[model samples]
Target: MNAELFLAPFLTGLGLAILLPLLGCYLRLRDEWLAALAYSHVAAAGALLALVGGLPPALGGIAAAGLAGAGKRLFARRLSGGASYALLLLGGWAVAVLLAANQPMAERLGHALFDGQLYFAGDAALWQVALGVPLALLLLRAMSRHLLLAHTYPDFFRIRGLRSWPTQTGFDLLAALVLALATMSLGVMGAFALVFVPTWLAFRRAARWRAGLLGALGIGVLAYVVAFGLALWLDQPFGPVLAGLLVLVGLLVA
Candidate 1:
């Protein structure tokens, strides 16, 4: 086995383990976990389009998702509660499947699109992880007070005229960008697990937001290492292997 097989996934996992947990911690705290997953699927469809269209997959995906996210405020207003996001999630997924189903060549990208082609992650993917992880962390630290207030006092926030809508939109778009880039490494479902599972565990286990963030990062890294080892040992698919481990960890931690 080429060492790069392990090396690429390890680095991708490390980046996600750091970046996603910070976003997840905030999403978990704010009750917007579903929103992240919803846009990630949209990004996945965008990635698939990129694959078929011969564009840069991550960039194309990010652009498509950002456009959709920008309009989310208006779209969400038309639907009751959070159901609009559900629409986006389903739309993205269905379109991806439909497009892939028509093209015989889609199989080439399918393995990475659904199950994770972490081994094949290119230099572009690596760079995204390298740069994105730190930026995500910085975003979290800078917005701690604002995030705390928004989640804790949403109604009060509106009353205070705090100008949180732009901030909220910016965060939403940023999350879309990260997820789109992460999909280049982890694939769609693997990215979803990375985005949601550890944060779920952290939210349940830790008492404070900061503790939850730290605990989630710890859980994500541990799970990534363990799952990669198990996949290599068993010659199993990395995405499913890691996802199962994450699910089990979420259960155990809960």
Candidate 2:
């Protein structure tokens, strides 16, 4: 294993190992865990479309997911809870498949989006994670209290005659952007697994909110490091290896 070649990708995954699980804590709190998968699917469709247009796939994915997050309120008005997220996921999947079938370039990008190309992640991905993670953390910190209040006490804002749309929409956009970056780096299912499994485990075991967040972050990073090394040693795909490891961990913890 060449350290020079693997370092950037390792760091990229590590950054997501931290960021995704933290966001997952919030998603689990809100009972909107499905949003991670939905955003990743939309990002996949956007990446495929970008490939067809000869644009940067990551950029397109971020843009598309961001749009979906921005429009989440509208979707919520028509369909509440997991239904809206399901709609986005199905719509995104269909568009991605159709685009991939029509374009050879898109087909290749689609495979990368689904299966992940984490081993090939370069300086670009590292930089994206480095810059994006801190910004996301800051945004999340600013919105943390509001999010907690909104989820724990649904009518906290309404009782005060305050609108929560800004906080909700802002968090949605943040989640979309972060998930797009994760999907581009870790693949759709890989990103979703990172956001889902660790948080689920932490929520089950931790007695307090802060403990849950830290536990989720710990679980994610540990699983990612193990998966990264195992994937390399066994010459396996990183995404499946990571997802599989998380599932096994979940079972053990359960």
Candidate 3:
């Protein structure tokens, strides 16, 4: 695969994994409406990227978007706190299984499910990164204020006549749609781990949002660079190498 395809995903993953949670953490603390809105934007971006880039990268993007939607619909609207997150978690597992069963989409889906040399197969990978990065950056900038509001005062937003339930409902639906499209590309693991791990680390270790973002980005870049070298050194598949790097970083820091 060309450098862009291999490099871009890693870079994009760094931005996304940390950004989503930071947004979530902020939203959880404040305006649920805005949080839901930011979440919606993420889903839209995923779908757009999936369509523009291809199938494999899209899968992961779409799945990440789907998680937000599932969270709002099946969990957030009816439950609170841990219960909502748990339900969404379960739904994610189920979605993954279903996605796996589609034989026609196996090659594309495999990239999401396993850590093999999935996306590292062609020149198309470069386009995947090129398309995803700008989209991610746009999402971050566009939703910045809204995300801040949503994470900091969710209940306050409801009280102020925001009609959070419907907003969340719409948010979930949009996210799911986007995720469906994105799943065609980067797959699930790339989508989920990239979005979660780095963000989690930044939150646990960094003192500020900027610090966390930088840290996560660094981790993402490092993980990919190391994975690339290791893959070459050991003559292993690229996907697993990248996946392993992510896991190793999490373990070392955790």
Cα lDDT listed for each candidate = 0.77, 0.92, 0.49
Estimate, for each residue in 171-241, the C-alpha lDDT of model 3 and write its tens digit.
34443443333233334344444445565676688887667667766665566566656776787766566
For each of the candidates, give the backbone clash count: 0, 0, 41
The residue-by-residue lDDT of candidate 2 on 1-254, one tens digit each, is 57999999999999999999999999888889999999999999998888788898889999999999988888787787588899999999999999989888898888888987799899998999999999999998888888898777878767976578757898889999999999998999999999999999999989988999999999999999999999999998899999999999999997
For model 3 the local lDDT of residue 98 reads 43
Query: RMSD in angstroms, all models?
Result: 1.8, 1.1, 6.9
Global local distance difference test of model 1: 0.77
In candidate 1, where is summed lDDT lowest over 10 consecutive residues? 103-112
Residue-level lDDT of model 1, residues 1-254, one tens digit each, is 78865676678777886787678777767677787767777887887788789886677778878877777777666775778678888998887788778866555665567887676766667777888778867876877787788777889878988888656887777777777777667777777787789888877768876788888888888887888788788987777888999988777767
TM-score of 1: 0.92
lDDT of 2 at 235: 92
Model 3, residue 5: C-alpha shift (Å): 9.5
Off by over 4 Å in 2: 161-163
TM-score of each: 0.92, 0.97, 0.59
* Candidate 3 backbone overlaps, count: 41
Q: Rank the candidates by TM-score, best first.
A: 2, 1, 3
Task: List clashing residue pairs in candidate 1.
Answer: none
Model 3 spans > 4 angstroms off: 1-75, 79-112, 121-125, 155-186
